[model samples]
Target: MENKLIVSSSPHVRSNQDTSYIMKQVVIATFVTMVGMLLKAYIPALGDALGLFIPLIVVNCLILARAESFASKNTPIKSAVDGIGMGLGFTLALTALGVVREILGNGTLFGMGLFGASYQPALLFILPPGAFLSLGFLLAGFNKLKNKKA
Candidate 1:
């Protein structure tokens, strides 16, 4: 029964939980983080809107569309693995961009001032173009790596 459950046509399983489930999970997580941001905004020590929540939602939607369109029909286990991989990929990509931007734009990592006070920050790294350029290149790199492995 287990073997049969794992085998089928090109897509090995069918279920009600498709890309929508993944998207819903991601949206929920994002909303939770956004609420944290809102709380920080109200605090005197952290009173800035990072603008991350909106982009996170957009990225989550894109991921949902891709997963639903490509991975939904696969076996449940496979689909779950794929979802985890995609989530990790998204997180790593985002973290890399944030690290680069923070180091260049603020001369610090976690506000510790790694580069010292003499360092002149590149303010553009925190701007919209920085996110686009970083994400675009990271995506291209991921595609290249995936194709090479394939």
Candidate 2:
């Protein structure tokens, strides 16, 4: 009577959690924290410039959309590749826009004058409306190129 073995009516249950899946989540979290810390520490100016946007990168729509639509269903390596490709595409697009905006608005590329002392920058390009015009033109150019390729 002292030793009794009793079994419940519930079925056996097992968890689907695995080492790799848990490790991947931990690594991603650690990486994002480290990036935010490093940005705050080493690049204060850029951190200030970016403000909340830098910290919000993890929850950005582009990242969230890709993670849900693809990363969750794909292998880690494939997901990483997709992330890298998307990051590069984003970087390139921003660089192109910046180059155009800076040259037209300030007559400079990264604070170095490209058009010499006599150059007169278009003040309109430096204003808020100029940003919209620049983006629209860039999108149009990219679309034209894409269409030509097809």
Candidate 3:
């Protein structure tokens, strides 16, 4: 006769994987991408090199914590997909915020002044609080869209 073991949670079921493993993968992926971006910025001397990596590192740490707490037990494919989704989402949000701030603060997109000399730029849009305010409203907008779909 073959012997078998019963797996359960609180007297029910259990699995081989756990949260830590998933989190490690997420951290590795995030680090890989951030490092790539850093190298790109450093080599070409493009954009705000220091600021770019700082935000990436900050967001990566936040994602790492979340993945450890919630995503580690899942399968590799699922975890990868989730990580990609989150990365893309973060990129989109940041890009949108950057675009708004750049256009408003510099009166330009990609450093070209659209408003010419007549427009006085709003300096506040480029400040730290601007990023937070933009993100807050973006989150609210996303929530509204989600609610509408449901």
Candidate 4:
């Protein structure tokens, strides 16, 4: 007697959503996030610090990925909610990351010194390498917590 076995990759599912619809959902979500940010922090100094990067958040990878992967497959309301969540997640992560790095590299956060004078800042943390290191650590932490909850 002979037995047959099959091996295959994950199956694909189809959805009725289209690109234009997904783009609209992403726009809606981005607008909401922007409005919230504007209301919460109206300081021009923050604007100056973020500058062009603030506008570029619309095209951020996190937003686009959520659009193509989550928004495209879900209803408009659901897509918008997902987009908002993802956008806020990015915002908080970057903010926290910058704060941590600033404290380590400059001995200050938001213009307030955490360490007294003569405390040598970890100059390396402010550099590109430090960005990478901080991001990696943050992602690892998020992953660990997410997996634990699941």
Each prediction's TM-score versus the true structure: 0.55, 0.53, 0.56, 0.56
Residues 1-150, candidate 4: write the lDDT tens digits.
000011111122112335433444455556755754784478767767766666565546446755677865789999888878888887898898998799888999889888899799999899969988888888899899999999
Give the Cα error of residue 96 in candidate 3, in Å: 1.1
Q: Give the per-residue lDDT of model 3 (tens digit) for 8-46.
A: 222221243454334444555566567667666676555
Higher-ranked by lDDT: 1 or 3: 1
List candidate 3 segments past 4 Å from native. 1-56, 144-150
The local lDDT score (0 to 100) that residue 101 gets in candidate 4 is: 90
lDDT of each: 0.67, 0.69, 0.66, 0.69
TM-score of candidate 2 on Cα atoms, chains taken together: 0.53
Off by over 4 Å in 4: 1-59, 143-150
Please give, for residues 1-150, the per-residue lDDT of candidate 1 as tens digits.
322233322251334335434545555556656665666767634434544554466566667766775574688788888989998987887799888788877889986998777889888778978767766766798899999999
Model 1 lDDT vs. the true structure?
A: 0.67
Tens-place lDDT digits, model 2, residues 11-66: 23113224333333444555666777788899988767877675465435445555
Clashing pairs in 1: none
Give the C-alpha miss distance for residue 115 in model 1, angstroms: 1.8
- Give the candidate number with the greatest TM-score: 3
Worst 10 residues of 1 by lDDT: 1-10
Stretch of 10 with least lDDT, candidate 4: 1-10
Error of 2 at 89 (Å): 1.2
